[model samples]
Target: MAIVDEELPTTIFDFLPCFFQVIGIMVLVSWLNPWAFIPSGIATMCMLYIRYRFAHCSRDLKRLEGITRSPFYSYLTSTIHGLKVIRSCHAENICASEFFSHVDTNTRVEYLFLTTTRWAVIRFDWVTVFFVAIVTLLSIGLRVFGRQFSSADIALTLSYSLSLMGLLQWTIRQSVEIETKMTSVERILEYCSLGQETSVQRLPKYEPSINWPSHGRIVFDNVSISYFQDSPLVLRGISLNIEPG
Candidate 1:
């Protein structure tokens, strides 16, 4: 969503200067103006602070949500596999309570994460508004006090001011989104670096006859089917032997 939604507009906003200054309508009122850069810097600093402050919180929230979700799914699978055993053991209430607790915890963490996101959005919006006002005010001051620019130039300045603010807002919003998205990215990287088991540990090293399975024999001493712990056995006490050379 960040790449598709946020990054797209952010890249488009990169064309703001070309859209304005290149057209000769806004000459001195380019994004390189001190008014634009100063406020942009301040807004960026604020966003950086916010990201740092919420950095640990965001990771913890994702972790908690993952923890809660896994157990809920585990419980569901176990329940489906062992409904009869759960009922027989009279653990229906306990199971239901555990499921609800997981759900409730996950819901709370999700809500908190959204709230933090909204708070960041609002802060960026305020910065955009303030930046716009500063640019407009400076342009007007230049005209009224020093008569340094003509009406046409003033109009151009105002337009560029608004455009610059939009560009600033877009860039900052994308930065915030990427910051949050990085948490998920970091977790994925961690998962990618996990240890993997080799099939040789489970498969026999011995090789069969050259024709392979020519005299293969099948045997089963005790094989059972149970999806999870504390679940009813779907199959048990099974034995079979088949030789088909």
Candidate 2:
């Protein structure tokens, strides 16, 4: 999770440049005509709304994807390690079916994440189109009634207006992508913040001295065991007494 969050191309370091470019373009548009702020401001609000709606959904999906991915990797690794035993036991079909099930589950989650992403991009593009249309119309009005601005100035503004669509979409996409990707870091931190294991309290009477056992014997009383604190117990209430041969 840490590797995917920090070392991946989707990190904030890669998103910052696009964010700055969006700001630069907005500034340039407003400089072209102060009235452009009316449309730009409206577009900004719409973009913010879109970002707000998508962020929650995207973050959840990303976290789910991260979780669903783990079992697949774990199963794959274990299967590879146990290939010899599995083959000798003639359990290849069962193992193969289980592997595919994990793959299918992981793939379904990934597809949903990608689909939600596309949905956000499409909405963002629509917002950008609206902004560009407003800018173009405002530019035409300024040229027709208010300004003695050069043809070149109008052309440049229109050109920037057209390019703004891509910049705006890219900026929003990166902003949300980076935010969603940070869920990986959040998951890692979650594991870090888990409660520590409780210390065992051994009674002095029951505690054995060093080299105390003369007979080779072992006893377990209502012993429950699990691989991890949160995992289900593999051995529950096991009582066993063994004597050496």
Candidate 3:
């Protein structure tokens, strides 16, 4: 167990204290550096606070963007359906203005949403840089002034400190990204959670047969359909009649 340069690979489990839930205790007692946690703890707390602060606002902004976009889509559908009417009325300029007006709200919110994410990234990076600086200063101070660490010890400290910074930044960035992306899932879940229409089985009092053109007349009246709830129907009371020879 104590040969120089030919020592057996250490396995603490076979030696002693290998019972029950004592694995973490072994790790801490063997390799834990108490000083390493300081900067990491600070960075983690700051990351959590920023994530929490942005959560509600980010969701609301995303929802607002959806609302604003609906108007533009409706306008596009309406314009396509009534192209001849629009051209006959000579309202291209007016229609274009209205479309842009509807789209303006969506553009503003989308811009702000992107900017907000960039702003958070900058802050997270700043926090990481500040932590690295603190670690560097402390390592040098302890080695030079305190004279408690050898050159090899200082090198090890610096290496670990730098490595941990990259890991910390990646963790923060990934956490924010996942949280932001989950908003889409939340929206889907919300839509799904809306009470579903119940089924009621009944015989139709007036079920029309598929036989066509027996009398050579077809008609429709007061029919409405909307893709989104609360949206205006794409076709409203569109009454029409067709005659066949």
Measured by TM-score, the strongest candidate is 2
Clashes of 3: 0
Could you give candidate 3's per-residue lDDT for residues 1-245 as a string of tens digits?
A: 02111221222222232222233322332243345467657766886677677665676776677668779899999999999999999999999999999889889999988887777778777876887787668767877798766777666666655655555555544545445545555666787899977665447864557784359777787668786669988988788888766
- After best superposition, candidate 2 residue 173: deviation in angstroms? 1.3
Q: Each model's TM-score, in the order given? A: 0.59, 0.81, 0.61
After superposing candidate 1 on the true structure, give the runs of residues whose Cα lies further than 4 Å from its correct spot.
1-36, 54-56, 196-245
- Write down the lDDT of every candidate, Cα atoms only: 0.65, 0.83, 0.65
What TM-score does structure 2 among the candidates reach? 0.81
Candidate 1 Cα RMSD after full superposition onto the native fold (Å): 8.2
Give the lDDT of residue 6 in candidate 3: 26
Tens digits of per-residue lDDT for model 1, 1-245? 34435664655566464444433422345533444455545655775676566655765775666557667888789889999999999999998998888788889988987777677668767766876677677767877897767778667666766665555555544544555555555656788899996554224554555787555688777888775658999999888998766
Q: Write down the RMSD of candidate 2 (Cα, Å).
A: 4.3
Residue 139 lDDT in candidate 2: 81
